[model samples]
Target: MEKYWNWEGNYIGVRQKDYLTACDGIILGKFYGKEIYDQNGNYIGEIGKNNRLIKNKTKENFRRPGFSFYVKGTITAPFKSCDPYPMIPGYEDFLR
Candidate 1:
């Protein structure tokens, strides 16, 4: 499971298996026949160009991206992921 960083470069969620998982290990979204669904199984988003997680513009609800234990602290990990594309605005509930 690789972590995804937000527009601010803060490590947010993760892509695990075929699901977009939160750093806390909660399943955020799932992949179904090429479409992405939220934890509640709502059609949420899709994989956009450059393999980015693009939120469904017509989605009724969304989930916020949470930080993981690996977030930059006193001692940061030597090498963490740095996603090229910042997280979508749909993940706006981040505190940091």
Candidate 2:
């Protein structure tokens, strides 16, 4: 359903090594000093490890050397329900 609809967004660039490291260290990095438990055996909340872990992971991702990658540019349409970009008229314009 998401692919069927047009959404305006930007791309993210990151390194492969960083990605793997982040994925492997996520659960451990999310460890807060305090832990919360629910009535059942489920876990509820943590103390102060949300934003800190995210920032650390982001830094780690950018630190990898020569790991450059880019994504497609963003396009913002005038109409919310439609994509008014690539402004018609020339068949050759569609190629881009």
Candidate 3:
């Protein structure tokens, strides 16, 4: 699994195949190609535009979906990974 970080370099989660697993081990969402969907199958965002891990264009999907919050101990610490893409100017408002 490849670890992902926010624009501030904070470890957010890992990308295991098609799923984005949080640091606490909860599966945050899944990727259908570059399109991201919540565990409930809601269209959230797409991973695109200069390799952005996620880009939420709509105001919807701002809240977490109904997924189990149990920590399954998937990630222990930040692993060696590439730095996240640079933050886009004026794009934060559309973030998920």
Candidate with top TM-score is 3
Better of 1 and 3 by lDDT: 3
Give per-residue CA lDDT, model 1, range 9-69, as digits (tens): 4454666666656555565566674456654556666555444455555554544343343
Q: Write the per-residue lDDT of candidate 2 for residues 1-96, one digit (tens) a residue.
A: 011111111111111221211222221111123322222322322222211111222222222122223212223222123332332222111100
Model 1: residue 34 alpha-carbon error in angstroms: 3.6
Screening candidate 1 with a backbone cut-off below 3 angstroms (N, C-alpha, C), the clashing residue pairs are none
TM-score of 1: 0.46
The better-scoring model by lDDT among 2 and 3 is 3
Best model per lDDT = 3
Off by over 4 Å in 1: 1-12, 58-96
lDDT tens digits, residue span 1-96, model 3? 666554444455767767777766677676677666676667665555434455554635554344444424365455544455656653441132
Model 2: colliding residue pairs? none
Please provide TM-scores, in order, for all candidate models, with all chains considered together: 0.46, 0.17, 0.55
Query: Which order, best to worst by lDDT?
Result: 3, 1, 2
lDDT scores for all predictions?
0.50, 0.20, 0.56
